[model samples]
Target: MNNKKENIRLLVSLGIAGVMVAGILFIVGRFSSSISKNAMYDPPSPLLPNSPFPEGVSLGAKILVTADKTADKEAGVQAFASNDFATAVTKFQSSLQSNRNDPESLIYLNNAKIAKSQVLKVAVIAPIGLTLNEAKELLRGVAQAQDEVNNSGGIKGLPLAIQIASVDKFDKIKELDDQFVKDSSLVAVVGFGRDEKIYNDKGLVRISPGSPTTQSRQDQTQSGQTRYVFYASPDRDNFTQAIAEYIVKKERRTNVAICLDSAQAERSQAIKKQYADFIAKAGGKVTDTECNLSAQNFRASDFITKAITDGAEALLLNPRPDKIDAAIDVARENKGRLALFGSQQMYGEKLLKFGQGDVKGIVLPVPWHQNANNNAGGNNSFGDKAIKLWGGQVSPRTAIAYDAMQVIIAGLKEGITRQSLQKALSNPNFSATGATGKIQFSPSGQRQGGVFLVKVEPCESSQSCSSSTGYNFVLVQ
Candidate 1:
């Protein structure tokens, strides 16, 4: 009887122990799964799964994500990820030799050579899947800056290694904030949509390469506080103010009609208000009849007719980048009936190509013009170098992206830590020379500089135009 009772007790105890162990494992599994889901790592290539590219090409891929499976670039990416820096260097070099216009390969090649050494790192988060051309343009600028710095002995002998992150949506930025902030080696981040407040709250230094939205100034209520966001381009207020001044004061157009996409109401409204305020201050008025270009069954001809009927002297075409066609339609409908004034969004090769003659004489504000001779009457060094490096023309996005990197590099010169670099940049005395001439930030962290105005003109026979459409953006004299 005693043996039986002892055996029963032992069995019960063993069963209880087993249950506890199972429970522990279940809890741990849940925790690990959560961590895996939220982990910030390089995203997989955005290429289609059914793409003809082979399997090995997917590993360690960044910009080479779009390259073919058998390409030297793909091999280099795989080798680089596997710590085979020697193979990576050779393959990337071979890839570049075949296609000199591949800035992505050039950047990756430079990064591979410095993989074994101590380096200063910065990341550029561009909308790759969303806007491939814009993303490439932005990357080219950073690539040029990286190539220049690495070739010139890098930042105080520490090679600059750039990491490229392609985000398709704005929410991805929020998901990345924590991981990026935890990265001690990453000194700064350039590019991304206008989500400065998110980065600022996380205490990460974010530089806007092309976003024109004005950021909040550091609140005086928080003593000794610093805002970590900085703008490398003009803010909307400054940009609109410049355009408004040129219209009301330069062009002397008192009544201007506004046309914008209703899909982007917030941005359009803000821009309209800013322009109206500036124009009103200068004794001008925005027309009462505003045109929503993205509205259903919208007719550009009817919009233009309404503006003219409402006593509008000039038309402010402020369409979203995706809605350039609508803006072009408006221009085509106008047919020189009213002066065309465009938002900076219209400044691109698309305008020259699609709008053609209709877009001619449209004045738009740009951060930099390639032919503007911004280097104090000398050669535009940035433009010249960009042409040689990419073997083609670059847009304002590239110039500003280069400037943003230059700003970060400037901060790195003072110190490499996040805090140290932020302090250096936040200092009122801090300044950096960029492709757009002198770069200085206001107390609000907005870029302090006058915006350049460019007008579309026919490419003269004697002059080389960057646009293949035989039209170019000439610096407005």
Candidate 2:
């Protein structure tokens, strides 16, 4: 009986040992499978799954990152050019992983973010009942660009997203406000006009390419809370100041005329006071200022005649659409005798209607060009690439808008937060190395300086009118 019992115990011990061995093998198999499935460090593939490039983005900027590892970067750029964003992104990712000491990688990474952000997830909440077609176009550009950035990979690992709510009027805006309050993914917003009160009420960050605060547009103080709201340009007074200075230097003329509608006329007068003071500082003169907003049958012939008679050598005219035509007519009549100077508003597609002949000798400052010196901003390729992306024809506002997007993306790549944005905007200075020249954001969020100047050139095969085109900086004279 004792022998039989010992045998039973031995058999049971053997069975337990066999089961333990099988269990160990099963665990080892699972561990190997997991590593194989998710291993990012496997013998680096020649190409990654997708180009690390962001989509719908065109940097046209040269790398500003450091120079030590140019080979890896060059390889990445080649991949990007070949439309292998995945491979490019992977190479960049690997380089970044190997060493975080490359500044060029930072630039490359930023570009990658821009391309990626386009592919990010985004939605739009455009204003309803837009007053003009241009507003709609502006909103469209913002939405499409945002959408492209978010779907790809966003900055770092964060995904980009947007939501759209259409509010036709005041009452409807109130309803949309309630909806906006509940959303969690809304990082920023672009509005139709400066409805700061409504924008602030919803905790939505606002950006407006066109201001509701422009002269005679509306009182921005109604929603004077600027903490969450940012502007693309300066307040009316500052913009006028930049224009005034450009006029004096580029034209080498002193006397100027200020013309506008009744409301805008009043604002123009106010701006004139500030500029007149600046003129004295610059050793220039603001001679013969004209403010006319309500001149229904007002003819430019008479105004030009009066300006010339008053000894005004340069005219600073800011009239409404019809008056703009009249002023150009008057300028045409003078023809090289009096130089016509116009406000920034004068640089638009509508000006094309005045006929190039009517606008020759007219000078204005523009915000965009094709081949600016590496004196603008970005990696020295911001302008031409933007033009190509815009299909050869682009507006000044378009370039500014693009730059604004760049600013946001840059901040994100640097670990974007609300605080980072404010830091960038406060004295935000982009080295002048691209198409738009050097861009500096003043404390107030205005592009601190101007690089663009406008001169009227004859339209193709036409003598009656001319188009306002941007000339090379060297060719401005």
Candidate 3:
């Protein structure tokens, strides 16, 4: 009887121990799962030692440090991240002494000074890791606006605080969506590639300064509708229509060849089709021959030969922004055999620098040009301010970004929340002064203006082209 009783007690104890072990394992599994999910959305801590901001912070080792230079800027970033604004200001000023052209450091220095008082926060989504130069141009515009606002007593006495979110890809924006939404102080977001739609769906006020891709006016949701997106640049349709109009009516070219990057088939095809439709309506035809610039076996000479054989009178080069070199190759091969036209992507310093004389006579539709402001009897106050701040010319991206921020600032005057800002911008009476002129948006959030056309020409001996290659994009008279 005693042995049997002992056996029963042992079985009960073993069963209880097994249940306890299972319970502990379940709790640990739940905890691990929660951490795994949070890890995907959480901003990664800075990899550099003693840096307080996340890795996505624009002013970190990933951006400021290189093999030869390391100390002041890095130290400034650490000080800024740790809330030592005074030390950060001193360190950044010292760092700028070495390189005054560094806009990243300049912006950080401005932010450190502004942090001493109440501030309204705004964020810019920059493609830092992917395209550093382009990202810098975008940031310069935002920085210029922030500097101007804060210096002039800020927006109703609250200084503007600028934050940078450097993203490598458009999809990476999704990872930041939750964090941005949670920050109630963030009034607006500027700059994105082709994926501003995510913010629109979430009802966040997003203004795209550089993206030419068009977005719909409204997004349908279960709770009725949302329309919190705005575009500062001209859409693809505007570009295609303008290019086609110029070719068919202005230049009188009836036969055209479409050359585009196959790797960016969606945007390329859309542009091709739109251009073709507009050309057809204006009495022109596009050659059926395929001119795939992204093809592995593509040759510019052979493509030009095929185009000539197909009775092409003009070539519409629609390569992706990154594939401008490929388009330049085609121009070199053509040797001005045909009239050349390009999309907005071609309007940059790269074309003048790399294409040189080969790209001369190429006409492009751009959002804003410095000459446009000059041609208007020196009316672009923003342009004058930018030149003074950066000590040189600024790109159309910078001009448009500056305008986007101006719009946000204008909206803030009506109210501070996202919903109030959206409502204010949506009103018909709303308008803001931009670099080029007055800025207004349509009901669909598109900029209410046509694009400017510019042509590449040789710089006169007396003219300062501001280009190393002696060619300049002069405003079309």
Cα-based lDDT for every prediction: 0.77, 0.49, 0.75
- For every model shown, what is its TM-score relative to the native structure? 0.81, 0.56, 0.82
Candidates sorted by TM-score, descending order? 3, 1, 2
Give candidates' CA RMSD values in order. 8.5, 17.2, 8.8
In model 1, how large is the Cα lDDT of residue 158?
81
Candidate 3: pairs in clash: none
Span of 10 residues, lowest total lDDT, candidate 3: 40-49
Which should have the higher lDDT, number 1 or number 2?
A: 1
Mind giving the per-residue lDDT tens digits that candidate 1 earns over 284-399?
99998868888999999899999999999999998877678899999999999999999987887788988999988999999888877546536648988888788777889899
Order the numbered candidates by lDDT, best leading: 1, 3, 2
Instruction: Estimate the TM-score for candidate 2.
Output: 0.56
